[model samples]
Target: MSTGRARRALWRWLPPWALDAGLVALAVLDAWINLYDEGTPLIWSCVALGSAALFLRRRFPLTVFLLTLPMTLFMDVAVAPITALYTLAASTRNRPLLAGCVLLNAAASTLAWPLSDGFAGDQTWTLIQFVYTLATATAPVLFGQLVQARHDVALQLVEVEEAREHERALHAQTVLARERAQLAREMHDVVSHQVSLIAVQAGALQVAAKDPDAREAARTIRTLSVNTLDELRHMVTLLRASGGKETELTPQPTLADLQQLIANSGIETTLTGGLPPGISTTAQRTVYRTVQEALTNVRKHAPGARAEVRLWHDAQHFGVTVTNTAPTRPSVALPSARHGLIGLGERAELLDGTLTAEPTPQGGYRTELRAPTRPA
Candidate 1:
């Protein structure tokens, strides 16, 4: 991977406790080197205690610094308290109070040791030693503050990155939703053309039928087909308007609308059961569309066939079955986009369901669907 990604991956793999352990090790090493140079047992013990306090710096930073500060003044120990002060400056929010106390202590230590009367060295060498002590004492605090500033910048970058990721996800969802609406409009248009043809034919039949039952059936078929065309136009308009501002939407047809559907069909269609219990609006619409598509296909390709629609509970799931026998006459030839069954299958899968459309041995067609009784 690239450098930035590599660093992020390594940081993710490394735990915070491991870094704390490394800090403990550094503090112990610094204190041990001082003790080995010219240290007595009592001084060594104090150095060890101060080094141990460094382990607790992140948890109780100010407390650890207070405990180690006194050790530096009298014991001549160097690393333990300096590292503690570095941690305090790096991690804590309060800085000025710590800097003031640290400067005062450095002054006291310089006066007590390097510039004391016991020093028989030259005044120039004493001045250099005082400068060295002041510089060394101030270095850690400066470095720690710089580290803190970098850490704050990293946090802001991380927050900006997360916000961008969330925005991208929402944009993707919006695009997918618009695509679905467009596809639905296309499907409606494809089916609406055939339905309008049936309405025109049925209007002709309504004028010629002699028996009361045949006339009434012909009238119902034409009326329902015209109604279907109107609904399809409304859907297309809604889909087109979706590209601009939001528009008022109508609720989709539910399974309850199938009564009018079967009545209006010229074929003798029998609907067996009402909608199953606990069916959501999504599944209800799926059921309505499944029957609508199947019946429409029967009208186009198997005109005057006997069809049956049955809904029932099968174990923990609900089942919808639409079956039609062979047509009495030859099937008509319309524009065949031929994706209706594929779309139905996808809709079934969306509800954790399955759809099977196949021809029967009697040269007929059948479509069966199974959907979960509960929403997934």
Candidate 2:
């Protein structure tokens, strides 16, 4: 992999033990400097012990502090690096633990001041040495703290970016699902009505060959087939280039399109209720398809039965109900229950709506679609 990617992978897999080992090495170096080169072995040994205790900073911060405090007192003042003390400070994320550790470090460092007379020869020299040593020792600790803070910031940035990516993915999925639903509705509107017209006109031509009506039936079938091809072509164009220039596609049909649907049903269709102006495109398109499917099924299954199409909409919900009068005698060839209603069900579900199909008590089939106005 690339260097940056490999480095990130390595950092993620890095074990805590490795970090402890590195900290221990720093402590050992400081300890050796104190014990081998510093003034007295007793005081230097104490400093070595205290600095060595820093290796336990992550696992047992309290224990590390308790063990180090006494050695810090005996050590020549401020012999240990401030980084070791900073590690102790960093281990305690709690404010109270940090406050207590700072107070203890300051008190211990001050208490050891009497052991160092190198500063007593001159007040200015002593003060300068103390200030320089304190600053130098604390520098590594402050640097480590800053590094830890930056690490925390980087982690938070990663979390936010991950959340944004997840949200974008979810949104894309939702859009795709809705588009599929719209495609199903479009296919249902195109195929069912066109196929039904072909069936009706072809059947009429069989019985009326001697009359001009048979020729008209033939013409109507040709017209419907052409229309079906045109609609299919429009859909194919959209799919080919993902929706070409706007003029190539027709405007999405709405309630206004229902008149042509009812007229083309051939069966007497009585539309009773009004639709709301504020109905959403999803709800409107769903209603249109539900009505079309219901009417197409009525033509296939009930043949000559009268159909009643009702649509009512208010501020909260849009509802559609299509019911047909029962046939005088049940046809042995009622349309098989394979296609239309199932597609409607999926469309309704996408909008958090519902579709129900059942036999009316009066003997005809009834299909109802209920869609809410508000998006969930």
What TM-score goes with each of the models? Answer: 0.44, 0.43
Per-residue lDDT over 1-376 for candidate 1, one digit per residue giving the tens place of the 0 to 100 score? 5999999998889886776677667766766665566666765666566667777888877787766654464444566667777887798667786677577546544553323552665768757766776777688777888889888777556545544553454355355546856776675767877898899999989999998899899999999999988888767644532321223465567677878878886678888976566787668777877887788678767856899999877557887899999987544344444455656676687678899999999988999889778842
| lDDT (Cα, tens digit) per residue for candidate 2, span 313-336 | 778787899999897433434223
TM-score leader: 1
Candidate 2 clash pair list: none
Whole-model Cα lDDT per candidate?
0.71, 0.65
Model 2 regions lying over 4 Å from their true place: 1-45, 77-81, 89-92, 113-142, 206-376
Write down the lDDT that model 1 would get.
Answer: 0.71
Top candidate by lDDT: 1
lDDT of 2: 0.65
